[model samples]
Target: MLCAICRRDARGFGFAPHLIRVAAPTVKLCSMRCMDIAARLKGMINPNKHEAAALDAASQAGGVYVELLSRTDLTTWSEQEWGRLVDVIVTEYQDTLRRAYADDPPI
Candidate 1:
């Protein structure tokens, strides 16, 4: 199975919230790196303490897009960069929903 966070092969590492009785669900990842990243995404880790370099590397390795959506240092980015980030996020969300419902019957 693909890593739920980065779309890479699971390679035997994975997480299942249900195993711990959490409502969030499960995810498979290729390495400990992705497990940490997924934890950060789920707010289980402090993003500030963990540098962005790791995330950037993981994103690049998995062909996943990265964006600084909630970064407090937004002033460092140009307006065009912000616009592009928004576009990427919106496009990704739409694509996910499309794929999710692709096989569902019409209402």
Candidate 2:
């Protein structure tokens, strides 16, 4: 396997075992430094996935739960409708952040 960071040959690997022996798979790493670099690389490669993961982490940390309700079709909406939709989304975002960080003001 290639190093996720420098794209060279991997020197080591990381792993997490499942309930069964065959279910366990390895996570390859070129070095301990590359292990950290791999995670960072993953976040950069797919930010939406990382954002979901971060929100899940925030929930675990006692923050407000995050849920993606639905994907909207903005192109079909009229200008006024689009503005309304934007307002709703921005308001929801503010509410979620406020709940997530009650100690902070209007995050």
Candidate 3:
């Protein structure tokens, strides 16, 4: 399966909302890199505030960071539909990115 964040071949890393009942589906990721990206995107960690050192380290290691700068437009969806919507949106974004940069060398 494609990684939820980068559309790469997954290596088993994953994320899922922790709920006692009605758990959201798990999101498989390609690597810890995409996992961190997903976490930051979900607001689980504020990378801008708490991960400065890690971000700097990644930059030094030749990692290129891309962020979704605009707010997501999910206001039309009901709260009960958010989990499915999130999954769909993430997958779509990953596919879009893959196609958009298909010819580019890895960063």
Candidate 4:
């Protein structure tokens, strides 16, 4: 696999344990620096207050990611950061759906 941003081979000797270096294209983040930058930029519109309310609403559906996506504040984020936030939220929604519907029926 290649790092999404850097487009470099991600199979270095110590890459396996980290697991992030080889993330699939859809999940590819290149580096924690990229992920953190994405998160910080997108944090503006993705305020923690809004995330908490959404988590509460999703709890009834037995979502597992209620803990991860939950935010508190987005102090200095920019509007341009909404793009990454949307990406993360969409992925989280799919993961939550799978967990909610696993084993039993949809909630």
- TM-scores, one per candidate: 0.35, 0.28, 0.35, 0.26
- Tens digit of lDDT per residue, candidate 4, span 1-107? 65322233433311231234433223234556434432433322222333444455445333333334354245543554444565455545444533433333311
Cα-lDDT of candidate 2: 0.43
Q: Quick one: RMSD of model 1?
A: 14.4
Q: What do the candidate models score in CA lDDT, each in turn?
A: 0.51, 0.43, 0.51, 0.38
Any idea what lDDT model 1 has?
0.51
lDDT of 2 by residue, 1-102 (tens): 864333347786643334234343445656665465444334232323333443454444332211232324556556776565555544454345335333
Instruction: Give model 3's TM-score versus the native structure.
Output: 0.35
User: 1-107 in candidate 1: lDDT tens per residue?
Assistant: 97654455688877666555656756777777667655545523222312333344334433343333445466876788667765565445434433433433112
Candidate 1 structure, TM-score to reference? 0.35
In model 4, the clashing pairs are 48-71, 48-72
Give the deviation of candidate 4 from the true structure as CA RMSD.
Answer: 15.3
Q: For candidate 1, what is the total of clashing residue pairs?
A: 0
Clashing pairs in 1: none
- lDDT, residue 22, candidate 4: 36
RMSD of each predicted structure: 14.4, 13.5, 14.2, 15.3
* lDDT assessment of candidate 3: 0.51
The lowest-lDDT stretch of 10 consecutive residues in candidate 4 is 10-19
